[model samples]
Target chain A: MNTTTKAEKTEKFAEHLDQANIQGRGVSPLTKLDPNLTVREAYQVQLLTIQKQLEAGQKIVGKKIGLTSVAMQNLLGVDQPDYGHLLNGMVIENGEEISFHKVLQPKVEAEIAFVLKKDLAGPRVTEMDVLQATDYVLPALEIVDSRIADWNIKLQDTIADNASSGLYVLGGKPLSIDKLDLAQVGMVLYKNGEIMNTGVGAAALGHPATCVAWLANKLFEYGITLKAGEVILSGALSAAISGEPGDHFQARFAHLGEVNVRFSNKVDQ
Target chain B: MSTVNYQSTAEFLHRAETEKKDVFRITADYPDMTIDDAYKIQEKLVAIKLGQGHRVIGPKMGLTSQAKMKQMNVEEPIYGYIFDYMVVPEGGALSMQELIHPKVEAEIAFVLGKDIEGPGMTGAQVLAATEYVVPALEIIDSRYENFKFTLPDVIADNASSSRVVIGNRVTDPAGLELDLVGVTLSINGEIKDFGAGAAVVGHPANSIAMLANMLARKGEKLKAGDVILSGAVTGAVMLSVGDTVSAKLDGLGEVSFKVIE
Candidate 1:
């Protein structure tokens, strides 16, 4: 789809989302009326719609990396997975109250977010490319959800499903990527003030930037470019820790500060 | 400022494996090691073990999912090592405490009759390089207590090396799209999860290519007759003792095991 048409569709779709209050009607399954559109095709169309919306006024904040875990690979039935962009408006700061109603179905993940110092542009992006481009890295939390109910999705289903991504929050200190030993960095996930799980940077393909490289290189095939000042959610330290309303989630980093998320009983308006 | 002599390190690790010394302790400071340096040590250790008698049965793939990356706060997938002796049979029981911090994942194992490596290898190349595919249960257990580890610790530990169980073999991808492969994983007879191979970078074979190119970047190539795990077909499921789990793939086969106290 052309970027221009995509922008228009994105605006229309966003309006539909806003009008539905992003919570009330939920999303209806697309079928029958679009005979030529497969689930995958419909998703691509949706992405264009969403992409256009973001391009209009919203600032693209970061991207979330998925399917980097062996378990998730088996669960999703894919080897390597893709990512979805996170807009500045999407991030819910640590300890900031979030409404369970604001989202459809959300899952929480602990991640290390990176802010690039320079634009990451390349047809052949490498780990070095990411390292050179990265300004700093921080511990963060990724709140993921799918427009597809129950996350019953195909590869294209998710791609068009906005990469099955949602909101995120950055925590702790943002350290230079070069100075930090990313592979050795550690993190702990706590729910409602209890330590639920712990992991390290090694969990990310040995290095978090490697995930960035994968994302950049992979997205190149899609003709997407990761710009400077853009943030990237590298990957998770461990598996996901599910949460609900009033449940508080915290991530403590070894060298970075802790990030917290508190879910509110209220739903998104 | 003394640097490690990799050859000696390899020999030392090999000796420990042959002696079956479970207490062969490595300093916890290994996380700061670079990938090149870590591989040097690993090659030596692996070579020592291979020379002494233990067989290198297969290689395990890690972090193949996006959700998993976020959960662990990681950005990329890591890797591990597997030994023939590490194979846990179908329906076998294992102790939860046996591992430092462990997780279970269902996967499709690609047993190679020929070696494969590539910076330019494609999915088709992997298929051409592969001999057979099998259902597998990979138990990812880190040696680091509480799972506090660095990249070096993991690679040295064989990427959270644990036991793996290979199910009945399926000889061909001829009828399988590799991407369309599906799996239903159940715990204690309860259907807990379901996923497909297409989720693995569009195809299970793509995972092998990822690994191959990754290895090639290190000047290493997957040797012939080496079993290379393509990657996880299903996202990992957390484990608990007394949990009996079974994963059935659409066309590949099924693998099952029990978790014990």
Candidate 2:
């Protein structure tokens, strides 16, 4: 059970997170500190951490969804998924060489990225609203990291850890969602020219836009609205793959072209 | 029995693997082998394989699914190394003369985009590091007689890893409902087994996370371009000569191979 006030816990978690990011060393799971921490309190802790990052001059870019698939949800023993805010510092360009030393522990997944042309605020946001909001969709690579040690996290623990959002890459050509069947779009991923995995749009809670719609509605509870020009990563299209130095990754989308990334073998001193 | 050095134990297993013969379980002789001792044996075996000109391709997780865990009566997953020599081309034939007691299972493979060094790796971190995922078929041939062995025995046997065939198709993992991706395995044009990606530790990537964290405990890390086999999604299907096995993954595509005399 929580021994401290909600505000105190939030502040403590924020400081812990900041330290983890700066030190590039993951801390113990937050759930270990307070077994009774609720999801609501966890989000509050997340917001507090995001506020600190904002104070440090990082601008909000968009949001990401985690645990959207039943497998992830079941692994966490949760019925619903969680969301995290993406800041400007978390954006990586395609083909960029990510230094291994900059992050605590990073893994990558393929996703469909949505760049909105119009703002969306929601209490009752529908998939149609997401489609109508109209922007462009592109192939994306999301680099997810955890501040919690060994990923021994509960739903609240990850929520407080900013939903484990790390960095992302947006590449390939963008296409309007209306022109494509978001649910049937085919995707193939490769590592060093070898086929690794394949997926389609329906993998993301039926459609990528549907996930964005869910994010919009979920954010509305906090009086937050998804702003225009933000890059929204719906969720992972397939199982996450562990990365290694000198590895090159490429994802080919049926309609969006290809997105590629490489990791640097040299660790920053 | 005094604890055997990893070298001798590895040598013993290597002979069995290379000579294509079964050996008595190390546990049968040692009786008091520790898990560390077994892993050390595995490491030594991998080193020997490396010395023999087989490159380390990636790592493979075993006993990740609930069915496997239950079958093994263990609560956790085990891992072993995959070598370039272990890869059987898709639709290729595997000679029965080369293996002892071979079996097959469906799996999902993760190819990394970046290196993952973990003291505390998470599933998200695994996803972020991944470049893509693909459907896979793993051939496990236990060197112990009758395919019976203890945990230490199996670990020392390199988790029974023998061969693997990856599907031709690759998919971006973004927005993929990996757990729901159904797998249908056929042998001789008949459905032999069926499962989903979820069978591998709920989601296949989670198994990779578990592998990374587990390896980190030993001061090892998953390198970039490594092709990791998440784990088996179904129970092993016994293989016989003239058997044609095919596994089709829901969206990822299918991989098939034949067992030849």
Candidate 3:
């Protein structure tokens, strides 16, 4: 139902996001620009921006799946989940202080990080394949930032904006996937020493590996393959917590150690 | 002047490091040890390493970032000595057998053009004395098991200082925005971490200034040509044999090395 051509919308959204990144200013949601944009068109828009980053010398490290939980899906008014490209520039180490100026409307969430030892490709990738390919599983913190102004985003808007992915932190000790049952693992998130939220691995699409399998099979439609030695961040285990400067956030996973991140007051120019 | 046995403690740490063995935290034996006593032990340890024909190449600042300070529940930065034996040349190989529980951190190394001695050195003064800045990767191997230690325990263990790899590209500090410089650390050709120079106490040069002041309290000084590692920009990444780690600094070049068994 959109009046504009797909190419035109892709170019427009790409330029808008590029400018937003460069100027440290968030723009209106993509859905606002074209209310009739289809999910397929939205993914094209996402690809356009990712292509621009690739051209700028940033490499693709892995991918992230979003809105995997029923709560998140309901919040976005979407029936299914979406995937996004994770670039090399989006990774932060555990206990690192992130600058406040680099992101717009940032939030933090606890998740599981899967480090793959074997390549997985296909329309038929299964949870078993994900388990077989996984080299280790570790605790991670995903700092989600919306390029859409004030986080005013719709399903298509976020899908077009790389599923609101920003940065991630992998820390604590990694363990072989065969050691423990991941679905029952409990997560407790603390902000400045106070309990902020709590969740379990089941919240991430019943099992974290299932989410990765979903991502692998989803990308196969576009002929993309999940490479070996790549790191994949499973969807958030709980609702996102708002980020603020000078805040200390820590996530503890049962059996898997803990990961922490802090926000600094410094503003990058 | 103090009752604490500094020489034996220093010798113990030196032997433990050279032997690549994990030991009990010093605090377990010396619960009443003061910070001053710990610093004396550190100095004695440095003297022993220097006596063994290893040159004192520079000094390293630790816990300079607010996040690390908060995580460790401490206040200010700490300083440690780096020896010539700890310098792993760019693109060199680090042996896992030589270290116990080693982890790598991305940082910025500032080489001074002139001596800086300070009771009150400012960040601007530190920058003025800096000759050039380059990307650096620090390999920290705590002699204590599981890396759990108190301030005295860590200080007496040379602040967990082990190895450092400096980048190839060098840029002058003049007119360069040292605070906003970005860094990306990759393992096996994939980025595993990213941060900015601002993480080092709001600015990299601030760590240098703090180092100058901290040294001055002990009547010491940072000499010209000293390579100062301005603390880690991110948390340490555990290293494994056969893994190649690389750190790329925006505007500065990259530093890389491989771990071998």
Candidate 4:
């Protein structure tokens, strides 16, 4: 019943998303481009986009997990989470300002970021394993952008769009977890000096460490080991808030200090 | 003297809040725990939170009802701090998983236009500093089992501060008789309880003035940007999953939230 197969469409969708990002605008959804793109094939599209980024000399520093909430998981009919590569180019210095037109339709989310000290090889990694491997935790602000027009995206569309990853800013305070309880941590997200949202560490699938464990196990099937010295943004603590040019965001976390980033007041493009 | 020291007790209570698990009352374990020791634990707890960069939004009152105070045999009501994180959106869903046993009640909130400090702060001073008064629906969740705790016990527990939903309507207190401000509490489209501002420390402003005096003992003053909750105006109602709670103030508009499993 199909003419263009999933694999064939995967190659085109990868290029399409790449161009969408490059043009600083969103195109149609990947599902609309393929109409039968499987989650597996969408990941293929994601990897190919990474390949394109690699060819442009961007290094893969880490990976990011998305859709960790049960509500989001059920909506996509997935039990676990989908991931996207975090490129070195995607790491923004805390409190730095980026051009507004650098990415299309950017929404910022506050998260708890982890820096790994040991490699997490998957299939049986536990929450304890994650905490043990973590070198330190910090506050993080992730600017999630979509290449799908109007953010009308399905699971496959976002999966192919690299889980809507745009850029991230990490807090300077790197705190150890020896005396800290990961589930007890709290975060409040602010936009333009007003409180936007608040959440606890348990919001990310009961505990943020659990999210890392799930990520490791999921990546085992793809022959990926979460390498050390990598910056892993576990998941968002609160809902992402939309921003306009010149908007500012500050996320204050319990024991983690604060992290902030702002957008350029004027759009060049 | 209490068996366990203040620091360890504060840490344990903080752990329960993080774990969302209820434990035996601190007083149960330390029967000799005095109101002074309870406040010492509370101070240490607040210090830990502030050291962790948690901003204290304002102070909140408990046992403001004379009847409840008389039952507890306490002359002064217990108080706690509301961290910035305890505030939820004006209209939002509160996940039950984040709390142990949360009860909802209507409150009148004061947003100060000017700072007020004191051992001798009066209700008139509180009213004069008031920028506006707004309605708030406070969801109090005690980490203690059965919500049973002494005055000192609740103070150390931050008055069981869990989540608070603020209303958008900001009415100036100068234009209204605060003592006569009546509130009706509803659950799932049914009225549950009703009371007026008079129920709180004779006048709602006096409750905040009392809170001001309490903070004065600690050498702290209410900040201009601070928000003070004038205790519960109605009897606390138990919330269940799928329950829509609405509180309509006499002159102020309604504030509500839905409890989610």
Question: How does chain A of every candidate compare to the true chain A by TM-score?
Answer: 0.84, 0.95, 0.96, 0.95
TM-score of 4: 0.57
Q: Write the per-residue lDDT of candidate 3 for residues A1-269, one digit (tens) a residue.
A: 36566577689887887677877888887777778888888899899889988998999998888998878888888777899989999989889989888677789998888989999998889999999999999999999988888989898888889989999999889799775666546566778986555555666776788899999998988889999988899888777999888888998776678899999976564
lDDT (Cα atoms) of all candidates against the true structure: 0.69, 0.84, 0.85, 0.84
Ranking by TM-score: 4, 3, 2, 1
Ten-residue stretch with the least lDDT total in model 4 chain B: B190-199
Q: Please tell me the TM-score of chain B in candidate 3 relative to the true structure's chain B.
A: 0.97
Model 3 chain A is weakest, by summed lDDT over 10 consecutive residues, at: A194-203
What is every candidate's alpha-carbon RMSD to the true fold? 20.0, 14.5, 16.3, 18.6
Per-residue accuracy of model 4 over B1-261 as CA lDDT, tens digit each:
547599999998998888999988988788888888888898888888998999989888888877678777899988888889888887789898888989999999999999999999999999999999999999999889898887778878988888899899999888876765656677987656655566676678999999889889979889897888989877788889999998877667789989999
Model 1 CA lDDT for position A179: 55
Kindly report the docking quality category of candidate 2.
Answer: incorrect
What lDDT does model 4 reach? 0.84
DockQ of each: 0.02, 0.03, 0.01, 0.03
